[model samples]
Target chain A: MSEKVLMKGNEALAEAAIRCGCTHFFGYPITPQTELSEYMAKQMPKRGGLYLQAESEIAAINMVLGAASAGVRVMTSSSSPGISLKCEGISYLIGSDLPCVIVNMQRGGPGLGGIQPAQSDYFQATRALGHGDGHAIVLAPATVQEVVNTTTLAFDLADIYRTPVMILGDGALGQMMEPIDFAEVPRRQCPAKDWACTGTGMKRPHNIVNSLYIQPEDLERLVEERFERYAKIEAEEALWEEQNTEDTELVLVAYGITARIAKSAMNMAREKGLKVGLVRPITLWPFPKKPLDKLSATAKRFLCVELSMGQMVEDVRLVVNGRAPVDFFGRTGGMLMTPAELLAQIEERMGK
Target chain B: MSADLSFLHSPRITLITGHYGTGKTNVAVNLALALRLSLSPIALADLDIVNPYFRSADARQALESAGVEVILPAYANTNVDVPSLPARVASVFDRPDLHAVLDVGGDDAGATALGQYASRLEECGYRMLAVINARRPEIARPEDAVAMLRAIEQASHLKVTGLINNTHLCEETTPQTVESSFQYADQCARLSGVPLVLTTAEERIAAQLQRPDLLPIRLYTKNYLERF
Candidate 1:
């Protein structure tokens, strides 16, 4: 039987990491998510686990890379600015095809932005992390329980794909307490770690996990192999949550905290005699493209609401392919469009 | 800002700010009530869009019963008539209503929305005060706190008039911390050229944390003050 306790998204994430057998966690502290580190700070030490609060995000994420190379489940976390610092490390992690977890309890940021909830990092997390031809499996979780659920999935997906994964969130979700059930993953679900360094011995002579490419041919082959793996990952793993999409006329595409708010707004829109629905992407990178393709056929229009101005809307338009009208409403720099505000957008979009 | 105006003007607008777990919202609510007793018309607008727990709105019904104006965004999608800004609230800011307090979300990004009311606030002569709880955020270091204040000021497009020192750990808060809070207030006053407006009192826990220089405090407990 599963026992549940009210936990913040961050705390739930910590529990998930433990259940995933992540014995090493390296991170620096940042706002809207100090609780995760605080919890880890207490629990990791007691469990004979390693929790190192590195000097900076760069150092912390690099530590994650080192631990993951040795085939131990590892993670690092930060809010926006700190995540910006982690970008260099993340690019390297992806380049090397190392498996690790990066939890960004997102706060507002262009530079040193406020510690309020924001979906602005969508663009940063998805694209433009270092100047690299690389991609991370980004998981956008909406609730506290999903925090644990997605985190466990992050570790699983990381090992399977040999890639880094990120769980994106905002301050509200990070700090708010909610009911959470703590359940152990089935032992059979644990990752098989054959390809890892694991201190290879005399039989293999030596094991190497390096992003370096001294020879041009080797580099080209490595890049092609990485892309091929990405292709397979994309084919197998893409998650989206659908609501009333079967015959829905209007669709609101959102994720993370905005998805929860959109869910509430969709409920209100229904009450106001409007047939509005939501399409929330759980996997931000392998961004559940099938639903977008399917919804484009039936849903007359789509509105992409985000904390950033129109970044995700761009993605929606791409998937939409002019099948229907696409609109946007957003609040950047730590702003949240209230339920009323979202409902207003829904009404206006419906031309009511 | 004039030195006297900063120090002596009625601190009509009490702006509460702090990290997530601090009692900033409760202090703001209690202070608003204290102001209601002293000043006729009072209002509390919860701008805590970022952090959802322990909001000033939790005490809205009690304050409303005491005839205090509470300005909140409209729940228009509820499909029923729910006032956005209550009549008393709209009226308070409209004319010579005495108290006007804003409970902004944590910091500047939350305060950024205050820019929309710059003209009206300037007309009504609202005072902005950044409340600090030194222990939380773990970086409630004076310099860091000052930076947060400057950011809040820039976002609101208004100068903060006074400093409110509300340093307390959860239930671990004590009178010693309250006394030390005065020192924090003094630093803020010197740095921003504002006065230490008020101190808080949890009547039950007062014996453990009493001080001579401290002002009468106002605190909130759900069971005690069923009606504000």
Candidate 2:
């Protein structure tokens, strides 16, 4: 048995990145995520890693791109608006097929919404992180322990697929404290970065890391090849957790912090003799459609809960495909919905 | 199985400070609520500018309803993350009749907020207690804990007169966990030349410990689902 220590979600994620051999961290401070950057600043140098606070979020993400291009494990983190500033760099990372980890401790909204927890960036993370037909592997962990596990996995997935990976968290998840043991975190073997633009040393052909292709045919060919990789990830990398789904009438679908709330509500509904269950998607980008697709065959309906105004509900609706009616309940601007409120929503949704 | 809370009586002003996420805010809130029974005109000032969430101000409704005046940072409970202190924090010091419980932030960064009021606090005669959780990595060892205490002292320009052992793995805490932390807290107290005044445990775990020094408390700064 290993010693378990209490740590905030952001601190745990930062420490997990260090343990998993993330050698460089570039970030700008934001609410709910400043602790991550602050931790990196204090500990990275001690652990023989580099931590840089760039002039802006745009500069920080570009620094991540520069570091990732050199074949090092690199990461950058931000909140919602700060993440929006990194979109151009994210697109460049995808265009060049660079591997790096990006953590978004999401706060509310379309613009400078609030410094409270929110899942409003669901569409931004899943559909339009950057302007392209590219996708990043987005993992939304519901607990601090899972935050550590997924952060390590995010780096591995990035290196393995040579595509960016996103750890989607909310303010509540980032700020809360939980007990976790680092010794229990799994370590993945990453392949060598042969494509990295490390100095050739006159040994072989010089490698180049660039997103710009002058010829449209060359760019299209590259994008098509990237789509194949995305297809494989969608098939093999989607992860989800199902609880009490057997013969259940109503299945609640949620990710990130809302999933934790939904789980409690699910148990409450069951105590009241309602056939309620929960499907928590740990992977938001791949969307975890298989389990939902299978459940739609038996479940009467789906309820999507979030800290946003109906973002992930769209994904649930798409997965259910009218096999069952999809419903949504959300609280915006950093307000958290209580389990009792969710229970009431469940009772009303079931027409009880 | 009730805790002996007499140790908290004479501080006049009690400022809780410790490493980040070591249950400082929880302890401050619980202490304020507990003291309100015997003490009059209780006030809790949220001096945590380092953290943007889960501050003592978040429990304003509960604290205010219990008749504990809650003084928060200027931008607390709002969308802004500015590290502004409330002008009313001076009132906690000026009014000699008020029993003030200041919830300082985590680490030296968080303690900087307390420095500006060092002279006023000294005039009012305060006892700052550093909460220690052996499970937290930065201050797990006695030497490290003392070093953090010294750093906080330097940052806040005030001496920590006492230590509180608050070791736990959140809800996973067991009596054994609290028992095992005794030596660490004792050593920290000895090394820093400060008295080990109290050890806090959850109400259930505290009953099992059956220790006189134990202060039984219900964790208030938990997630909504944890309480539900």
Candidate 3:
């Protein structure tokens, strides 16, 4: 048996990326996620990979774009504000049909919000990360081990879809310590990068990696094709976990660190004779609507808890679509909601 | 619940140092809380500037209520991620009567903050304890553990006088996990020439280990998903 090693979520994510053939890392330092860059800085050279600290987040993401266009597994990470700086490059990567991984250890904010953990970037990650009809595969893992698993799978998914993949972590998940086994990482077969911009030695035609389509009809055709891929991803890649939802009336919906807290709250409600369950979305972009759609028929109510002022609740409400009443309970501006506090929300929603 | 803390002997100042994610804050918090039972006016100075979360500031309410004075950075647990140190951290050196427990940051990056107080710590006579958790991949080997210990010493300009085996897999720790780490810790002590002072575990797991110097401690730091 492979020995389990304890690691912080950020460092574990970095190591997982390296283990899964991420040969290049371009990053800038930001709180709650700097350790990922720090780990890459220390270990990348030893593994014969490149780790460059770019001048800024913009420089780092464009560096990622450059590396990914050459058919190498590359990644960059940042906190909430830094991710905002990388959006234009991310859109370029999407428009050029490049594959890479971008990690956002989310902090509270519209602008320079607190460094403590917050999931306020749900809209940023799942909705308008880049200014176009484009969506990165946003994965939200609650535990450090899950952070590893998702990071390892992220590169593969990006390659499979030829799109940028975002590992949406929070400050708490980035800083917390947990045991993870690197030997247990699952590897998927990625499709060949035949359209890479690698120089041809007069053997094949030159490949052009550009996002600038001047003609409106040409841009529309490419975007429509990308949407077809997005449709396939939404149909096949929506991931979620259901706890006690088999016969529960009150179901709590959360993602990232908030989901972990809601799990504890659901257990406390269960012990007090209230039927409570939890729906945790592991993939935030795909949004895991199928299970919620199925549970909306039986569950009486759904409470969306987050570290933001009800961002993910909008998605939950839209998914439930009045099949059941969806309620919002949250704490914003870097404040964390404890299980006891969430239990009170559950009990109040259950009219107890 | 106390597992005979007689084997533990902290000087006027005890600085805890180790790699990141190796439970430095956990050990420092547990030691300060346990020592407060008999020692008077114990203060836990959070000198970690590297990590933003899971610092001693997170356990300030518990330690303060237990009569342990908690001194941390002003920006700790706040929205800002500034790496500035507080002026009150010097109170540990000013008050000679106070038994201060210093929780240094993880690895050499965090230890740079502790280097600022090296002169005062040397004059006052301090014992720096390096924590080792064998389950951590970076320091799983004895040589890597010793190298990390030496790196912490180089960064902080203070020598590690003792070693504490605080190895565990968080909530998944078992007697076998604690037992298996014994050789790793012992080898680290032998290589670094530092005495292996104490092996910490929960009271239940402490009862199972056959060691003379075991300090059974309750965990004060919590993972959000642990309750599940």
Candidate 4:
């Protein structure tokens, strides 16, 4: 049996990153996500790793870029607002094809929104994390244990694709606690950082890490190549979990903390003989379109529940594509929809 | 209830304070619930102004439904980040019959909020207990634990009457871990001149130890938001 330990979601992420051999963490203090930085501040120094409380979120992310350029596993964490500040740096990392992890312990958004669990950054995280053509591999974990497992995978995915991978969590997942077994997490084989900008020492040509191109043709070609890589990632890495979808009339689509609440609603709807199921997207960027499309073949309808104002519902709608009706139920501005409220919505929609 | 917790005699007011991540709120919740086993008119006051997570006020519904009056700040369970102490905190002293348990904030900065009620707490002859988790990085050493206790005392303006050894590594905690922390706890107790009033372990570990001073408690810090 694996060693089981109870830990807060944020703290667990820090520990998992350490176990995954991440030696550098740079972040600024922000609500809900502060514990992640706090845990790093306490543990990183003890482990002889670099933990810097950067001047700002922008500085922290740039620091991550520098560390990643040096051929070492590195990460940076922030909340929604802080992530917004790090947008340019994120795009730079993407353009340079640097491997690093970024954690967004999401809080309420749209210019200094309150400190509460929110998924308002869905559009920002999945569709447009930064300006210009860029897409990060976004992994949304539903539990603390998943946070641990996915964090390790996020590092591997980042390295595998030479791109920044995001662990998009919210205040609830950051604050919540759960028992996790980290004993047997299989490490993936990543390509060596042969292109890293370590000192040349006259043995090899100097490697440059930059996101700038003087020629439009060169930039266009680079963009096309990056999209090709993204296409492969989309085809291979899209992940989701299905519950009771094998025989169900309605499939509930949600992610992160909302998925946990939706699970309770699904169970209640099942007890009421309502044939309800849930398809929780683990990788939000890939959007789990294949599984949802599969469920659309048999399910009568789909309901996308989220902490935002129906951001992910757009993805569900695109995938379902008139084969089945897609509806959205969401609560924004840091308001959480209760299980009872969700079940009532499910019944009302199904009854109609 | 375990035999070890029998020594708990309800005082007019009990204050629980400790370093951050030391399981003070957990201890406060367990103590309030255990005291409710015999004491009447129990009130658990959430005085935490430091940490946004794991505040006693978040468990208001459960505690109140169980007939314990819960006193919280104006923004106790809300997403508001302001640290405004409620006027109802003074009401706990008004009701002398109420066995009030104050779950203060973590560390000296958090404990500083308790300074406003220092005179009231002192006059009421309260028993302030410093919950110690040797696993916490800030107070992992005996000297660090002593320094934290003194800082909490200086900030709260209330002396710690006893030490509640609550050392554990969360879900990874084992009986051996609890047993090993005894020395650290003893060092803190001896240096601070505070009695080791209680030692807490999870129910399973507590059952294995059978120590007279151990208080077996169910974990309550996690899932605090799910209850709401």
Candidate 5:
């Protein structure tokens, strides 16, 4: 058995990235997510790795793009506002087919709303991570252990698909301390970065890492190819966890911290002789629709709970597609819904 | 397997300070709860302003429910970034019957907040314990540990009279990890001119060891969202 260690969620992710052979980390300091950059600043130098504190979030992500272009596992992290600043760089990375990990320790935001945990960036993360038709592989981790496992996986996924992967964590998940077994991190095989521009040394053809395509036909073909890859990802990479949904009338859909809270609510509702279960989406972008679609066959109602005002609820509604009544419950602007509050909402939605 | 914690005997005030990520808050929380078993009118003050994530004040409900008075800064549990110290901190000294525990923040920046209460802490003859975690990279060596201790002492304008070896990797800690850290702790104590008062291990690991000074503890630091 691997040793279990108590670690903060943000710090665990940074360590996991290091252990997975990430050599360069570029990031700016932001609340809730600063610990990750701080940890990297301390540990990276010791390991002969590069840890650069960029002037701004924009500068940090561009630096990540430059590092990833050299065929190394690279990463950057920030909170909601900072992530928003990196949107252009993220789009450029995806358009250029560069593989790198980006962490968003999410805080409440439309524009720096608050420095507390929030899932309000659901639309931004899933619908549009940046100003392009590109999609990022967004993995949401609920526990400190998952932060390690998912972060390690994030690097592999990014490389496997040659796309930017986002580890979407809220402030609560970043700040929380939990015991985790690091031995459980599953290692995956990543393909060699043959396309990287390592100064060819006048040997092979020059590899141009650029997203700009002058001809409309060429750009359209590139976008079409990326969409084909995304289609394959959507079909194969949607991951989720279902608890007590085998035979229940009501199913609660949530992710991240809200999912954990909803699980408690489901357990309490079950104890009260109510048929309630939980569907937690581990992959936020590849939305985990099939399992919820399967549950819609028997479940009489669906409740979408989030830390935002019905952002993920839209995805739930789209998946349910009128098969059952999908109700929405959320608390925006960094307010947390207690288990009791979630249970009350569930009970109310169930008409009990 | 209950090793004696006699080192905690009859201190009117105890200040817990250490480098960041040294598990000072966890030790302080456990000490407060343990002190409640024998002492009366115990107060656990949260003076941590550096790291916003883990603080003694986050466990206010548990400590208060266990009859431990919790003194926290204004909006300690909220997302406010202001490091405003509360007026109630002064009240901890008002009651002579109170056995107050100060969970100071980590590093010199964190310990600087303690400087405001230095006169009171000195007047009360407080016992400040420098918690050391040998696994943390910054304090992995005795020289680094001593440097950190000096930084904390200088910043807080207080002296550390004792040392507490709390060397463990979060969930990865084992008996060997604790045993191996003993030399680092001993060297640190010898160099800093402070007595190594106690060593700590998780209860499960401590049960397998026969060390007399080992204090077995259940980890109390958890996610704020986690319910009791």
Candidate 6:
């Protein structure tokens, strides 16, 4: 009952969202990520999903908050600026303890950035999605199949953790189409809706979903409780794929689109007698520090490859604890580095 | 009922059908878009209940913006495990401004749903075009092609309006095969009253065909906002 179908990463996400019970979507037009929104626009209507072409990123994020508070597996997506606007809502959802999916099909930006895919949002998504003392369950899928798999998992994690889950993808992943199995998707066992604020009626007391805790004591209590949930989520959702990391002298740490290319380059270096392997972090937030730290102890050197000016490399350095000499490779503003370029980097580092 | 001389009827509703490698859906999508210059409000519904990969509706945004109403089963409507046809499509029957193009699954038991919609299609006035790709397995001969069309018309309750020559080998297709397809289409036209309304060639390959009188074709993949 399953077969291979070639699809763009964005297309696979839409299909996966449908398969995984993502019936509500709100997004604005952003290049490199336009396909995803376009997919939703055409397919959502037919599928009976709520697809709103939000007036602005602010409106879009609020729409997501509205839907998420209703407990309808809601999601809103944008690139850099769009994601920045979404941060406040993300913090709100975290404070209010509402579950939802937030996809950052990352594009280059500090402000109104270029449409080219970039990983600059790593810290934005990983450290602080919005203004607050909070964390998000962020997943970075490297393949088209993983895009489907990770997004589906994001929905589950958001529900289970009652927090927002960020799917960190760049333009390269969004645009490239590859063969995938849209069928084997497991049915999502919806969590108890007792957490949702869908009007309690007279069933006990009137339910309320708000980030506004008027009392400082109540706000501190809510933040502390949410942090407890975040701790549990961090323990549970740290995901990374280790490709030949055990015996390798030099290990490359990467994620999302860049990670796939890194793996290919590492394998090429492996063939060329350079002992380089790839460690891909599937969840950027839980950041896979323990495993990376362990690898750091054994590995003679570490390399971090990224689309930005080596942002994740900083995380790698922090996790490495100076156990190994860390190196960095990068291309910014949507320029993709080929396997050849990465292989050269690995070879150069090995020569060092 | 009256002389509905709209673009949809000018190039009748023909279906491109076959197995996975048969190039039917590809031909169907290309053909529908190629005929777009004349503003054909083609209804390309992927009844590919067999294989959900590369569905016609994936390109719905392009067609819809071009004023072509695309039909696909409501995915978000219900939690139903299997995809069922939308009830509103029955209105395509009464509306002359519409054209109904169905891309059904392969010849196996997957195509049985066609019988249910066939009669309604007849009353609504649709011209079903059976597609043949010589390179497709089990559907090479004219007889085999006719049988596939017959099976679809029986299942879908639509008449074979004509034949479409969609002889392509994906991105590797050449102008020669498309030209030979044109000849095969003439043979099909001789037997069936439905005219061989068109043949498709990649814009590059269409340039290679170099025939001034060739029917319309879909050679380019248009982005969504470019629908007009």
Best of the candidates, lDDT: 2
- Tens digit of per-residue lDDT, candidate 1, span B56-94: 666878789887777765431121222233334345456
Structural similarity to truth (TM-score) of each candidate: 0.66, 0.97, 0.96, 0.87, 0.88, 0.64
Q: Between prediction 2 and prediction 3, which has the larger lDDT?
A: 2
Off by over 4 Å in 5: B1-12, B21-23, B29-43, B61-70, B87-99, B115-124, B132-151, B154-157, B165-193, B199-228
Could you give the interface RMSD of candidate 4 in angstroms?
5.2
Give the Cα error of residue A266 in candidate 1, in Å: 1.2
Cα displacement (angstroms), candidate 1, residue B183, comes to 42
What ranges in model 3 sit over 4 Å off? B1-10, B224-228
Off by over 4 Å in 2: B1-4, B226-228
Worst 10 residues of 5 chain A by lDDT: A1-10
Please compute DockQ, using alpha carbons, for every candidate against the native two-chain complex. 0.03, 0.61, 0.67, 0.30, 0.30, 0.03
Candidate 3, residues A1-352, lDDT tens digits: the string is 2888888899999999998999999999999899999999999999999999999999999999999999999999999999999999999999999999999998989899889889999998899888988999999998888898899889999999999999999988998888888878788889999999889989999999999999999999999999999999999988898899999898899988888899888888889999999899999989899889999999999999999998889999988999999999999888898899898888887889
RMSD (CA, angstroms), candidate 3: 1.8
Q: Of 2 and 4, which scores higher on TM-score?
A: 2
Shift of residue B123 alpha carbon in model 1, Å: 42
DockQ score for model 4: 0.30
**Tens-digit lDDT track of model 6 for B107-155:** 5334566667666655555555566665442354566666666666666
Candidate 4 local lDDT, B107-146, one digit each (tens): 8878999999999887777888999976665577899899
Candidate by candidate, in order, the iRMS in Å equals 14.0, 2.9, 1.8, 5.2, 4.4, 14.8
Please identify which of the two predictions, 1 or 5, would achieve the higher lDDT against the true structure.
5
Considering summed lDDT, which 10 consecutive residues are worst modelled in model 4 chain A?
A1-10
Candidate 1 docking DockQ:
0.03
Error of 1 at A62 (Å): 1.3
Candidate 3: docking tier: medium
